[model samples]
Target chain A: MKKLINGVDQIVSEMVEGLVAAHPDKLRAIENTNVIVRADAPVQGKVALISGGGSGHEPAHAGYVGEGLLDAAVSGEVFTSPTPDQVLEAIKAVDSGAGVLLIVKNYSGDVMNFDMAADLAEAEDITVKQVVIRDDVAISNPDDRRGVAGTTLVHMIAGAAAAEGKSLDEVEAIAQGVADNVRSMGVSLAPCTVPASGKPGFTLEENEMEIGTGIHGEQGVERRELMQADAVTEELVQHVLDDMHLNDGSEVALMINGQGATPLMELYIVARKAIQLLKDRGIHVKKTFVGEYMTSLEMTGCSVTILNLDEERKRLLLSGRE
Target chain B: MKKLINGVDQIVSEMVEGLVAAHPDKLRAIENTNVIVRADAPVQGKVALISGGGSGHEPAHAGYVGEGLLDAAVSGEVFTSPTPDQVLEAIKAVDSGAGVLLIVKNYSGDVMNFDMAADLAEAEDITVKQVVIRDDVAISNPDDRRGVAGTTLVHMIAGAAAAEGKSLDEVEAIAQGVADNVRSMGVSLAPCTVPASGKPGFTLEENEMEIGTGIHGEQGVERRELMQADAVTEELVQHVLDDMHLNDGSEVALMINGQGATPLMELYIVARKAIQLLKDRGIHVKKTFVGEYMTSLEMTGCSVTILNLDEERKRLLLSGRE
Candidate 1:
């Protein structure tokens, strides 16, 4: 494939440089670490929020580390979790006197690494609170929770609370509240390439799409028959609603995230079906987002995430949101 | 392709449903329209900040609509612009006694359609101000100002300001300032397929990449010989920095956005080089976001956007941001 770069080894650093260069107003590189933080991070009393996973989902963990979202983002290699030290550095970079909150997705590596870093920070008296988002309902990881698309909600809910000067406990509780309210399911069509190898990560036939896939293009729940977008939405939403136990008349927040390769036309088509399916089932949607919040590189297909809204949860999610 | 959908026609609606379902507390959907508004939109007499384009680049128009981002999002069909009537509906829905500021990307159709809708809204005496984001450094339409990647910055700067209860004139000034300070350039590798056609929108040789492309897999300025990721970063950044005439000590925000398909590893690699290039050039990066913010569905390459920032722009971009 055609890429714009000097060499593979230097691509990530170069891109980070570009990121730092482009937004000198709000971002800075953590010294000697593969992390980016807001220039005004560690706002004294504000709980510091730090979240990161792989490198490809940009404007994500890092782009989000601004005034109201995240304070710091620890980036791992592509599709990989940051090394513990990287997470530790991020924790150090943004740790305020108040405390720090580590918002991790349900992926094993991300969990273990960030958890270890949190432990280290706590040893340093940082008082880290951790919230793991295992909200994807599409693929049932036996006895394990795999992080998927809904992780963004955890970041926003937690980050917003923290930005508003909530304590670590409050931020953690709000994040947990968001986790309790959210469910996600994903579908993957085309396979993506690893940056170093420039080769497809998985193999698929012309008429195949893997259901319940993660951002890394790993096997999802099943390889069912390829169907139209609407059928796929039905299947995905069925799992999400059932998993979340959402019923008719329940209000929710919806997220239809593209898995990288799917175009807006197709994704919007999927989004429409997702909304119609909820309406048909009498679910009252309070809010909706369709686009690439979380993504797998170049993977075709999309995922749907729904957050059931309760008064408290809604208040927190919407509190200080404006 | 394998997709979790029941039909094509209903995808967008369903996806919106799923999104709303996931964040009921944080967001709200307008009845019977593709438009989405913040749960806390139109706070008293604050200006309603509205912006949108196609449906694929999630979080761009809608995700940014929460508290300090956007007041309403008007979605068009896929890469197409939202209809004027739809824009009108959103304008009316979120008009909170104060005027509304429409942050539109620099696409021709988007500008024309949003302009038409603004005129219609003007008839309603809702104070309306608009800033066209023709920020893409990539030359689209040759003779016309190409609105490419940098439009997202406009949304961000303006959204942050508007969220802080900025007046219509204040929001407009911020939007205009951001629109002036940002410039973007994009490159695509392999084109991802459109969902309906189940075929790639544009094709590149397996080893080639498309440079200076639009977010919708539209043609770009250059399709040079394929190079390593490092080389790619150098060439793209050189073009971007040169285009912006960024002085050696200028501070800016760098966005390394993945087109749909490239893996995270590649984006990170590219990000690394981007960072180094800027530092070497003596450009102080204030903020950096690397990910798929504005994507060209499933296309294999990435784009680089630079938003030059100053103190005032920085303050607005950071203050009261959620």
Candidate 2:
């Protein structure tokens, strides 16, 4: 695999160093740990928000750490959950008198590790709450669903609520509300190589694709000949709509998230079709985001996320720093 | 080559539609044209800024077309320059009595077309000025150096200057200063396919890379074995530093631009090395931007841009809408 990296073992640490170096005004790395926090963290009385998982999804948990988003993000090795110790460091570094909330994706590894971190933090007399996001609608069993790009929406709304000095319970409730209402589905045209493995997680023929692929290159629901962009986008959006049970006059926030290798040009193409499909169903798109918010390392594909927005959610979603 | 797109013929139009649709609050498309303008265009006393070129460089021109950025951007087909007529439409659509400034990359096609558009606008009594950016230090012959990712910095600075109610001449001077001081170099591990051609622009073995590759997939200065991220980043930054003649106490802004397919993790790795190299030479990086600012479809590599800065330029660069 032709990847731009040094030793595989140093990927996460080096990346965190580079990230903090590039944005010293906004982000800082905790010494000797894979934890990144807002440069001006631990506001004395504001609710602190923490979210993180694996390393490959750059700009996800860490990139979202700032004034109106996450307060701290603890990164693990690629496609692996962070140790509870790292998460606890993030919790301790960012938690002020107002308490801390953990916004986690629905992967079992992430859920377990973050919960352990929360338990550890509570033992130190810090109030902590947790919200698990299961926004991916691909799995037939809701409990088996994996959070994907829709977790970005949760980050924005909950972070905004927390930045507004909401109580820990209020922030947790807002985050959980987002997790309950958002849906996402993804397709992959190519697989990504883990730096350490030096092999693609999966493979597809030149003209084939995987529908409903998970972010970590998990087996998708189906393998089929690649279809046109509009057709692929239609399938993804239709699944989200069906699961959301939205009728006419519903308003929602739309996100067309690119896997690492997809070009922004193509993401916008997918966005066009997604907006058209949603409009045809008489659903009003309140806000739309089109870019790589969550990504698999070097994977070529896109995911469509629909967040059912209420008046309060819409207000908070639009209130963040650009 | 797999891509998320509909018919090749519809790629630019659909992408533009999606872009404008996704950002209705900030952008609008001129009716029946591939021209995107600020939603509140023709801001009558503020000098207008216009920039455009081939469409594959997503977010370069259009994504920068909001407040404190470009007043308008014209998009042509993939790897092809926008026609003078389309550029004229953009010029006419956004020009106010204060006049308009054209920011053109140093490519022959883009330079010729934007110049022609400026003439067309002048004929209509709308004052117009132009700045040609030739920031790529890859070509030994400075006259042949191609503009690359540094164009984004030009957009940010000149656009901010224009947004501050500067006259056309004043904005032109600032843009020209930026173009004159910036230097960039890139390396590509693989080539990207133009959608219309449906073939890779160039080929490379798994272990090879093209050093100093242009944004349009042009042949590079050298082909060599792929190297470690730090080594590759060092080579890129060294060339830029040599060409810029920066001193130990100098200050500048650094940009590590992803070509397309490179993950953000890898980009930050490159950024880490680039920043360290600059520091070792006692140069301070006043600002740093790391992401896919300028891209060449899905090419797997990155470019480094260094812009020598002064107090005025730094203020303008930091004064834009984020």
Tens-digit lDDT track of model 1 for A1-322: 3455565565556656656655677789986677999888767888888999877665466767787788888878777788999999888888878888888888888999999998888899888888888887655662365667777877766777777777788888888888777888888777776678888888778777788887787778898667877788888889887777676688887878877656544666677677888889898776666666787756677888999888755665665332
Q: Please give the range of 10 consecutive residues that has the lowest summed lDDT in model 1 chain A.
A: A313-322
Clashing residue pairs for model 2: none
- Expressed as tens digits, the lDDT of each residue in B1-322 for candidate 2 is 8998889999999999999889999999999899999999988899999999999988787899988989999998987899999999998889888988888888899999999988988899988889888888889888888889999998999888988888888999999999999999999999999988889999999999999999999998899999999999999999998898789899899999999999999999999999999999999999999999999999999999999998889899878653
Question: Each candidate's TM vs. the true structure?
Answer: 0.72, 0.99
**Where is model 2 more than 4 Å wrong at Cα?**
none
Native contacts matched by each model: 0.52, 0.83
The candidate scoring highest on DockQ is 2
| Global lDDT scores for all candidate models | 0.75, 0.92
Tell me how far the alpha carbon of residue B94 in candidate 2 is from the true structure, in angstroms, after superposition: 0.5
